[model samples]
Target: NSTKPVIYPFNPNFITDYKGYKLGMSVEELDKLFAFRKENKYVNSAKEFQTVTGVSDSLLNAISPYFKFPDWVNQPKKQYTSYSNNKFENKKPIVKVDINLATQEDLIKVYGIGPALSERILKQKESLGGFVSMEQMQFIWGLSPEVVENLNKHFIVTAEPKISKVDINNASVKELAKFPYFNYSIAKEIVTHRSMNGEIKNIEDLTKIKGLPSEKIKIIALYLEF
Candidate 1:
């Protein structure tokens, strides 16, 4: 027999038969989930999970609270936004956020950023200590331009991290590569250039390294000092 579930969040896609049973899912529902998995498909939301599993509303309400989805699936969208201006067209302005200081909990309040996306944004921020510029938001994987624009509506980069840079003149290739922006290959190239030429003077110096992404010079520049 399956024991009752303690209150905690879990990915609904990972639900096994025992987990389903304990969560009060019918055999039919479990079968549907199993079949869906065998076909390599997914259920994105609580509403969709109910539709697929044919569960009662009561069961769905109880189980849905724990249905964690992959970041892409649960990102809220604006499909129903009315072009016709109504009461909402002239509502009070939202309080703006300094994104550098905002926590995971604060990010979740944004329409598109659910728990998963919030963590992703925070994780990326933590890697760089904090954002040096709002433009760096583009580097975060899976954040759509529309979603980014929505974030910009309320959030701004009001603070900058005191980023301690890898001194290419003295640091090893492994040390330089530890920055998310630099790969081992590029890190090695930077070190080689430093050995043959001298200390990398500026962003222009980094561009001379092959395999260093041409597009990333601006963002990469932020994480380095002399």
Candidate 2:
């Protein structure tokens, strides 16, 4: 017998257009959030939400409890003390990681990366036959720029992959397509061009193929040897 998993309650921020209507907000009040969103600004606190929306106290009280903010915004404000009555500061330095060498455990030790994302990083690295540059990490699917910044703070690319590259002039289309950067169409184009032109002399030759852009030459070059 299949059992349904228990669903837990989650915070609902003023996300969709429906929430304001359901919560009994005035059209003018609801429009404020949409206007703010259009400007790419956020009402990070309940007070800020009220300030933006001009909601009455009763309405503010009803909705304020459900307002969710980012962790940085939620952090308590620091209090200053006199030098004579100084408080001790205790801190632990964040450990650095080598992106090329980090295991799942090491990846997880970074604040934001959980098990699934760590696994994905490792899997992408493995599929790529290991990363050739720190910049290459940007290509990992689902890694946001913010997380990439965090990863960069803690990690450095110290090594390049030692795997053998394909002989592009001789490799079959299917073999070339097996590489992550090349789909069958591009691979077929490469092979057909090589056959017609006699041999692909270097990565620059790929730029001559129609629809295969120069940016692709950089990525596809990683797996190809002249």
Candidate 3:
């Protein structure tokens, strides 16, 4: 949104006239519309107005020649702030997100979430039945309270996630690495170790790996399915 308020001249001499055109709009309406146009135009140009609003080039050209804002237009006096500022500062309502319902890219778009955090959110969603409220986001390992609160401002829970049942016994090293806690090396170790031993007998086997600490194991376990 534009931070500058719309400027208009107090004197009417700055107004321009075009043949057969009517300034039927009141001054207040025109000022409001002008401000709206300045902030909302997807394409910021005279040509865009011509193309989208069906205003002809010739009409635009005629208006262009007459275009002159009064002296006051050149000296803006006040700042423009969106009304959302006050509303945003208040505690937002709890919103639920189905981790399975979100695309990885969508998850990343959350305020405090990056690729790693997104993966963790997805994994947790899969492990549990899916998030029931914004609070569930905090369950993901390493997700901070501040980050969760920050995200609450922008995200809402809408639908249930569609979790894929991962066969830990058959999943590839690359697939395992996609888990938030297990990066390339850790995922690779799990795959290699499993290949040698056949299949993991239980979730506890994960902790037996040298570098796989209990904390990391618990996080990985959150998303794993038999």
Candidate 4:
């Protein structure tokens, strides 16, 4: 006659493949738990374990009683509150810096920016003379909307850089392509339109040019003169 295997208290975080089989956990559930553990995360509670492994309620009830978590996991987290008796506490106000004047050090201080990204931002700013608006930051590759939002919190385009505006009416396709917003194709289209019609005057005139980016007409307008 075969004797029964002894059941003992265990940490679910350290459950091995063989041990998981004995606990009646499916292969997929065990794989999920292992994958979660590979990320260096631990399930501190039975509910969390079920969440990670997708275990049934009955199995969770049967196994959870035997789950032995560390003492710290069971303790309530402490909260500290600050109370000041001084009425004349001086707090320094946060000052937003001009993006045109921001250094590499300043750009990297924002949460999502690293060395490579900071360098790219500086290069783009240098190429464009300097950023004219916060909206221009959206064009920087690899910057997520959240990162851009964070950048807006710390930087603003207060000091406009001195940029020589291009004459759209007189500029060649190559000359027009030099602008940050225009590509070779769009530049060629502008030149073709100017040749076919009279000189392109304003944003409304640009809308008539086929293959021109309608959305960027406003931004492109900033760097162009009639």
- The candidate scoring highest on TM-score is 1
- Give candidate 2 misplaced runs (Cα > 4 Å): 1-95, 210-213
| Best prediction by lDDT | 4
Q: Per-residue alpha-carbon lDDT of model 2 for 146-200, expressed as tens digits?
A: 5677788888867566867878888898888877767789889988898788788
**lDDT (0-100) at residue 81 of candidate 3?**
27
User: Which pairs clash in the backbone of model 3?
Assistant: 96-157, 101-161
Quote the lDDT for 214 in model 2.
Answer: 60
In candidate 3, stretches whose alpha carbon ends up further than 4 angstroms from where it belongs are 1-145, 152-160, 178-180, 195-198
lDDT of 4: 0.82
Candidate 2 has an lDDT of: 0.70
Give the per-residue Cα lDDT of candidate 4 at 136: 77
Each model's lDDT comes to 0.77, 0.70, 0.55, 0.82
Clash list (residue pairs), candidate 1: none
- State how far residue 200 of model 1 sits from its true place (Å): 0.6
lDDT of 4 at 103: 93
Worst 10 residues of 4 by lDDT: 76-85
C-alpha TM-score for every candidate: 0.61, 0.57, 0.37, 0.58
Model 3, position 103, has a per-residue lDDT of 81
Off by over 4 Å in 1: 1-75, 78-90
What would the per-residue lDDT of candidate 1 be over residues 84-201, giving only the tens digit for each residue? 2477654968778888888888887665677888898998888777788777666677565556777888789776777777676687988888888788998889888988888888
Going through the candidates in the order shown, the clash numbers are: 0, 0, 2, 0
